[model samples]
Target: MELLQPGESQATRLHTPKGDVEGVVTCVTPWHFRISVPEDKAALAATWLRDLSDGYVAFDPDPLRRLPGPIVVSDSEAQPVTQATGVPESHLKPYYIGIGSTTDLEPLPAFTWEEREPEQLRRTPLFETHRQMGAKMIPFAGWEMPVWYTSVTEEHLATRQAAGLFDVAHMGVYQAEGPDAGVFLDSVCGNDISALAVGESCYTHFLDPDANVIDDTIVYRRDQDKYLIVVNAANDDKDWAWLNAVRDGKVRIDSQRPWARAFGRRVILRNLRDPKEGPDMRVDIALQGPKSRDILLALGCDAETRKRVLALKRTELCEATIGGFDLVVSRTGYTGEKMAFELFVHPERAVDLWNALLKVGEPMGLKPCGLGARDSLRTEAGLPLYGHELAGPFNLGVGEAGFGSFVKTYKPWFIGREAFLAREKQRQTVVVRFRFTEKGVRMAHLGDPVLDRKGRTIGFVTSCAIDSEGFLTGQAWVDLKYAEEGTPLYIFQGKPQSLGKSPAELKTGDRLLLPTPAVVLSRFPR
Candidate 1:
């Protein structure tokens, strides 16, 4: 038997009472294998199961099927096993599996995760800190991140009632500068960049030629010739590639990307995350809640900076010094809360700044939150998540969003201008707001059918959750004919079934649409 790594191959032979057999590792995840054994050697591989350990066990490839020949039973245990280990395979220490035979339908899956241990995942600067704080780190966008600190419900309420701090360093923060900064941004981004004066930020989208969103981002105008574009972490690479393609095609700038990629002769771009190698070495942090402003105030800013921060309006960014360290602060957030801000600081001082905020804001009931809380908070506010509610290079008519309010047809030119206009004229669908009418109805999920009174599907749920603010809440994209305010609909719930031994045996019943009133879907339902 061979203990094969994912995408790698190996072969080994097993020696037993009857004789010896050869096996090859076929797959790693489900522990698939192909073996060749003489009739006499088959039983020897099956009965060698005394030292059954965790990742080290004997393989019984066909446990449930009638065995080629298996007449060996030990009184110790009768449970069938899947993972095979021991003997001649000991030489392959780090990853070793011995050849074996027998009948077992479902073996415990232990080796799959062994191949993907925690150390194998990418770690952020705060990886150790998160583990110390008891944060349950999970894989997100290729980074090991804390999905929740304590509880999503608790963290959500903390941010709503008091304050919650979030590590947003994983976002893609790019800086574009030089004489053609505004021109480059205006031409590639969907929003009107000329209107973005210094010290201000705006919600915008990077659109493809077809006007569909490459990513929803916040563009901050640092100066007339400089801007900082913050994009979702998951789309960092795609956004970088798209930006280079867009700028290179323009052939007007020649800035460096390693320092910050060059789009033309004067324009240069650099990533904030790579501060050591780039211009900005700032870690992103989000402080949000009803008391968020108070916490920022308590960060020990000077009177002048305090006054400036107090005077700033929403979507505004300003430079300020806190505890003698300079920070870039933005009065914007995703949770739909009034007192929220996104702050950036030097990586060397992130832990200090984080500690300062928690210490200063502890009296105000501030808590360090995780992505789970951030998601729930955003969902409660009826915001659209990239993959779930908004994705692809969408036209004006796509999805359940009408961010066309941010689109500028009056601008000189930009990506997707013509395509967006054409799609706008051919608009055929609309997104709507909805809540379950019947008590005890479960929250809807993506692709769950949305039916009308006659039980015909007119749309499907885009985002749904049994929210803390209210009961079953969700969003759906509907046919223009059925996309009206106060329109009633139903969300189908799929039937349940047991886990299966193989892919073909997995049974899942179709969702049954229940007559529950779900309505109010005009983008912003009100």
Candidate 2:
């Protein structure tokens, strides 16, 4: 084989099952090289690359002089190669080309030429209020949000027993409006957007073409031509980009699920959290628990608005002025409470609304909650979190997360519909909620392995938390055969610090680090 230096320009022909295809080498490294193909031949080149296993490519520095032996290339590490090759960055577009076997290559230690300064954490509109209340703040999804005021357990039980107020302004709020709004949403979301009447909302997921969940969201139909989408804080920017890509016709949908007629120009999306969008900008605050209705009633609102709030049901919303603030009130929340409500208000009014709710509801056992309690409550409620149950290293979809009912498979066409259906037909694993039957065990963590009776690894824990009942409650993705309710399992908790030496070094360390006994339940005992 001939050796080529970095940035060496050479005409190359790749031999594949299809035929020999020509391209120009744009960049080269010790392990990989990128090829630039003509735009018209892009599809043919892709097909050639996909068909090759152990292929050969001939390089000709000059048309008259070809290399003595063709370079043997094997497809490995399909991910983009970011290693620093001596070659200067090229302006020409390049296609993915894998070369040489990487099986024997040792993994490179992570290093960076320049240290990047840490990004400053963001603060919500009610940051000052939380500080004044002596809440313990921590970094969460790029925001310095409160984790708890008094204690996580205290705030958690308060929400379940009476009421708890939460500052959820960091969540992403978006609006889609125009003639084909519902049609466009129906094409992108897994749920049946057309089924939602004005003033109704439903939980759904944004799925990629492979059926992996992009993020789970709540879509509220605020008007005939407008809808509100609430997404997770960590996925706000990604969700925004994905929505725009669909709107601009940049993303491809399956032929079976064709795009809506005039989808590109018929709908307009707005980031409701953008202050530049004017006074209409919105953020979220939640009032959840059994006494949420009584606290909302005690607020200073007109008799008509109070009656409307009282009449609201789960998954229903209404535009109302409460406590002299104009906002949209929704009977929805992450916590599993029948009387919970999430209020969407302008950023300037968030602090006032929070204070107002506290003043009126504090007498009714309403406690200011934070992210810690929020997570614990959701875990106990068997709700799915984005990076945990829905999608992560496991690439779990709605079906695996036990929320497949929310996905309207009956719809003839939607993004990922075909792939999701195929996945469900072949699925062998499922996520199940479980609780530790005993106490004094370390909290289960993400990626902790789950084991069966004979010590066979079955699955891994997705999310876990200490619930209001002081028991460790968690969700795990286990093999389908082991997902039956009341199934016995064990969570392999890693070695505690007291065990001292590494398990490989200590004679008894492996025996000392024991798996916590757990039982799969139909759901957390709500």
Candidate 3:
């Protein structure tokens, strides 16, 4: 008998003692050949092959019909498993047969993730830190990132009840300066930058020529003529490319590569920039929760700074030393709780500052968290993530524009002005919500189907999750027609069983189910 080539299909007819039987010699090895037979004839095939080969052939012997063929089972009863060594395969692993109950089928092309070419994506400075922290890293926005440090539910609860820190250093930071800083921003961003005075910050989105969102970012007005924008990491290059492509006369943009790392201790982003040169910046630390202000007070911040923090207003940048190191204090945070602050610090002093915050805040329920907790907290608070909720340059109409009443009126005209203003007048608006059902509760993820009362799909989900209490929740940007408070909808999770089979579905209330059982507040909405 001839051995089968790696990719070749082969068939064989076996002659047995009891009867003459036909079987496909589907797999071949140096020592033996593997064969497949009809389900009803599986036992007969196994007995015949084993008896004929004696000690020469070896393969999995199961009562079931489907078996991976060409296995060199002579050495042992076990099949020649490629993954026995616990190492991922360097090449495409051979497909093994699985137990089947077949229905109407269609032939299709085959593909694998291993066959795709590598992409040149930038890595964050904190990449190694994430690995050391035991993060379950996954690919996100073209970067390998931690999907969760521990359990998503555990991390989510940690943030809601107390304070959790995140490593968001992967985000993109750009400095826009020159005489045309405002002019350039006006042309590229959707919000008005002309009104961005120094020491002020606002969240805004950039739009493409087609009026789709390019990226949602926070523009920090460092000076009358200088601005800083924090963009999504995956779209950093795209945003730069778009900026360079559309850059008009006089506006200069600088992309901050090798991203500078800073840590937040007491106050974040205080005294973070050089007045004469460098980016006028601050290292931001979010202090959240009812005891957030008390934590600052315990750190020795002045009364004025404490007062500003209490009011959630602009606090005078003051020096409050913690852990024997000083930090520029600014009251800000992402959690919706009463006391939160974004502390600024000198970049060189970031590590010392962060260590200090952890040291002092630990006694008060502050935990050093990774991106996973940060994401869950934000999602629970109904905030939008970059790629999941607002992938720009494509889906701009479904963003925060309709809800940007706070920042829109304050700026000079920015990019997407014409299209946004036009679309905003007649856009479908909806608030995303979490739905837990009696059937299995599945967290809504990106691309999950959003259905209306009649089960007609009207939109798709951007995010979803099962919180600490085991309640499933996710958000979706749907048609305004189905966006009303208390609107009933279903979320479909799995693929349909067949061409005519229905996908998995769950029903949920569209309105805000605040104080819902199993819900926690760990983050302030961005």
Candidate 4:
């Protein structure tokens, strides 16, 4: 019931299922628990508790098993399984149990932040391409995704110094067009879609009633009264569902298939694996970095084409042909670097386009990058990660600084509009930093409290990490009282134990708690 590290404790129960059973409690992230019954009766507990829904209980002499029963216990209460009646704390290994609601435990003076994994969990249109490039695949937003191809540092540095590529096709693309497109968007999203000029894009969020962030997305004005909403992959279903439920416009909502040909045979297919394949969609490649413009110019394109393509001042849409494939090029990159553009080409010519771009940028050290590098680069840039940074049921105007200001006042209204606006006045904004420790361990995740130099209760450490340079970094949304610049804070490596009197005082440096850098704000912007 408590978010504590793995440990053992003794408990006395009024009624004993297995007489005088003593067990131990183990700690995991967030709040989850598992109970170990004695091995002699573990099988009985498993079968007897199998159908119980309150919680899962299981026993495995050799392996762990989940049994039936919702074992309800509190932070102060201890439930134990004894060596005679059940397994000892050392004998019973801990495993994933289940999620606990806010009401289930004592509401900490703070709350833990979590993001929704991507939905559909399907491979991107370029799944095979990522695999072919040897991407380290993992589950993100429900999809098997590339975390990184090489080291996050190498790839991150590559994107900064040269150019790199990413399979961003996992990003969801929704098309809204027609007379009411702008109006429909205004009513569904948390921004004013009406002011979007042609060829321009804006960042916005969708929220729930409690003002928790649902998702953050880029809304591009494709044309007059037409918009393309590029959203986080994990929020695809939620975004679409919220839009569909709230949309009052005659505007059509379409999840456009990647690489669809304008003139090719048209057919609707559930998945790309279908044997009856039509002309595949275009391949999108991002050419980015300071020398990106020069590299494109050297690729043999005409001066006008290069200007239209290389110009990074603003996003431009241009038509060109690459490797015999028609292209729709956009001058945009994620790293906030120099001239860059994502090329949209025919799927049939994807490999050719990728190879050509690689060949052109190779001299400049342009490496074929992966997701790990992209994450670090963007994180350092203070760019929001779809799931980690933005997903929520929180309000916009009041939650984060500068976040609500840039948001268009009017938006496609979502779950939290009224309630968010109402509570915006009382909310305190704090930023989370992932700082590193002396051991070179990079911090990650949230809910770690922040302590001042005196060990006074100033704030909590929300997130922490060690970057490529061995610099420890972290971010947290702390009390507005302690959020001021130059406020000294310490991040603890171990969990905070409430000795029922006061918090334990430990040396900051030894516990991985160090003074936050002077440049913390630059890396984690409001």
Candidate 5:
């Protein structure tokens, strides 16, 4: 091949009793030739070459060149590829590069390099409002936000009893608007994106090629050509990059971290993206509890706004004016509670709206809550949190809300469709909610393992909580062998050293597996 010059194309077929394989030599280097094969056959050629300690190439310039071109049957010890593959000859085929064939088989660029820098923390519109209320502010998802006002227990029970206000402006808000919006969404996203009608929303998973989750997010349909993607705050940058890569170049996307001004009922989003990391105009506040609807109704916004907010169904969105601020309001919440609404507002007016809700909601025992209670409430509802319960296979993070149903199979093409299609046949192991029989408030930590009768590790706890009834509840992913509804399991102090990250993901830690008896609850919580 050293004698061959660059751009001197030659059709070459290798036949060392390895059946017939073909490719076009586009470039010749001193030591090797750059062979371009059909993409489908590319992997085969690469693998075959790696196994060849000795082989000969046959140049076939014949247009009529076909399979079995020069089959020199081998009586030697080393078998041909056909025999090595243990497959029939019918599967082997010849290669043909049409006259003046043009192809691009260049290697992709190397891994990207990024210089690390300390992130500057941010504050919300209600930064002072939280301070005045004596709320404890802490670093959460790169934002200085309240964890609790008085105590997590107080806020948790209040959200259960009456109403509570939560500042959630730090979450990422992104929009993708174009004529091919639905098509772009369906191809790159998991679950049903076009299934949603205008004014409705659905929870979906972003996935990699292996059908592993990138992030679990909510997709809202605002119009026929407009859609809103709400992602976790910490995942804003990564999620944006993933979406852009998979759009198949339909549309260009640029986004930055979202921060806002006013604390309103719903956020009416302006353009949320910028070239640089800057303050975002959209802000969100969650009003939750049994009396949440009543408190929203009592707000001094227009009558139509009140009617619209009241008319929204679960996972529904509508435009409403709270205290005369035009915004989008959605009936959604992480905590499993009735009548909860997340309001998106501008940054400046957030203080006015936050004060108004506290004033009007005083009669309903409404109080401003923080992150501590948010975590507790969501755990009680069996919702998985990032870096805890939810992780897909490869990213080593991102959890599924549940299984199978949310994954759409009808889509002909998607990033992870092939992998998921194959996964459908396998017995699925999903997360389950379990609890200790004894009434106690003590709960398991993130890495605690769940064991079987013989003390073999089956799964580990993802999320845990002790509800008001003293019911210890949590979620975990157990293998099919010990995943029955009435399966007996025990909680150990730490993970088993023998446990490794397998298909079941059973191995989690390196601590002693001492046992505390527990029972497996529903595979999915009711």
Candidate 6:
């Protein structure tokens, strides 16, 4: 029941006859407050607020006051009123009135809600555009993202043969600046950050002290003391916390890494995705394929800019103006394409750039791709996804995923360097890519057992997908003995649909379904 002062916000909950509603309450003005609740439960919440307050609260319906979710505005000065004039029944305003102050209330019991509402899914800047294009959307990494515009196979094939555009704006963008930025990064990142020259970028992993893969990221050296980091969308919050912890010296570092021991070094971390950061705000858009360079050139940059962009090699980036929007253009991508480019542009211009790219590149077979094609493309390219090949249930690191060369072992220090080396020497399992020899089989799923010809379990599938060539390609973590190239293996798929036996009736070693044959490849045939 404690009132928040103007410009203050607090996490609070309200007790209603129906149940308990939890959300944040902010005091926008001395006499006005705003209550924010889940968008899906807004109507019910409004009714509960009215009932609890005994008609003393009045809802404000000002258009300018509306936010992304349902917002309830209440005028504290208008309290003790029996009725509110001009209030619509269908569009009731939300406001809460506490009967007493927090100090006067009895303590409440801690109880979990049986039916918890799902957290609202966020939308990218191009969400409306995707809907207009009839793209099928699904929830991915807490965002409502397009799964595919057309069939996954068609989009996948177009990218490999021509070019594909992706709205990777959902990915996280962060900035590290100041004299000690490189030193701070080098102390935490597995790869050596100080070695990167201006305009150069490198693939690296953020490692915990125990050598676990926190996240895989790409660090771009934008200037002498400024660097940009792009991380997996799902790990954005976690990665930010981890980076701050290291910067603030909250996380311990080994004495061997003397550079990291300087806890109070002047380093500034900024979330580039946050608009409050002003000019540093950016979102990612990727153009990847064989003709990706051509598509970029067609965006109408001037002679000098075009020359610089064309000269950019792999892992190189430059600030350039294209189509009247300034962007950080990098010759880097998740897809294993030599000519790929990832453009970092202001969020306000993301939609304009996306439309411009599609318009100019469409004649050359450039298609707007979605998450499905992106996954399949990366899978075929043998790139590691964070949850599958790197961490998650498998708990594999960069070394286990066959990218140990990316780790700078000679750096003398890094958060997990020692642990990584120790684990690499004692590794008993490795992740490998494989291709199904035959067609007409279900895609292998995570945790599906990989078996040898003798029906002995040798490994488990981490990820799988249908390639453009009509073959099931996948990555798996298997015993070291079966990690060689061209090793024949079989995946034990679950029981077929036609099987009459229940799952509980299936006995060990009984064949419920035929095993799919596959061959371990040294690398996927991209």
The residue ranges of model 3 lying beyond 4 angstroms of the native Cα positions read 1-133, 142-144, 178-180, 196-198, 248-288, 296-338, 343-348, 392-394, 398-413, 429-431, 437-440, 467-470, 497-526
Q: Summarize candidate 3's per-residue lDDT along 264-346 as a digit string, tens digits.
A: 11111212233343444444545555555566566655566556445545422334554344554444444444455555454
Per-residue alpha-carbon lDDT of model 6 for 307-331, expressed as tens digits? 9998899999999998888999999
lDDT of 4 at 7: 59
Once model 3 is optimally superposed onto the true structure by TM-score, how far is the C-alpha of residue 31 displaced, in angstroms? 86
Q: Write down the lDDT that model 6 would get.
A: 0.78
Overall local distance difference test of candidate 2 = 0.78
- For each candidate in the order shown, give its overall lDDT on alpha carbons: 0.66, 0.78, 0.50, 0.52, 0.63, 0.78
lDDT, candidate 2, residue 195? 83
Candidate with more favorable, higher TM-score: 3 or 4: 4
Off by over 4 Å in 6: 1-118, 254-264, 495-512, 524-526
> How would the candidate models be sorted by TM-score, starting from the highest?
2, 6, 1, 5, 4, 3
lDDT of 5 by residue, 1-526 (tens): 2224555655565442345566555443322346655555655666555433222432244422222212222222221121122212211111222222322323222112242333777787789888988988888777899998898888888898998889887787777665456655765566677678899988777765566666777788878767878788767766776665433222212111011011111222223534232443566789998998888877767776777777899999987777676667889888888679888776777788888888899898998889988887887777767666656231232323355676666543455655666655574455667777777535677677777898787777777775545576777767666666778888864444643345464555634335677787775456
Provide the global lDDT of candidate 4 against the true structure.
0.52
lDDT of 2 by residue, 316-362 (tens): 99999887889899999999888899999999999999999999999
- List TM-scores for all candidates, in order: 0.69, 0.74, 0.59, 0.62, 0.68, 0.74
Give the per-residue lDDT digits (tens) of candidate 4, residues 231-319: 66666666665555334211212112111111101111111122233443433567777676666566576566666655535465556
Local accuracy of candidate 1 as per-residue lDDT tens digits, 400-473:
36567777765534666656667777777766667777557765677677788897878777777655665667
**Over 4 Å off, model 1:** 1-120, 250-265, 392-400, 438-440, 494-516, 521-526
Winner by lDDT between candidate 2 and candidate 1 = 2
Write down the TM-score for model 6.
0.74
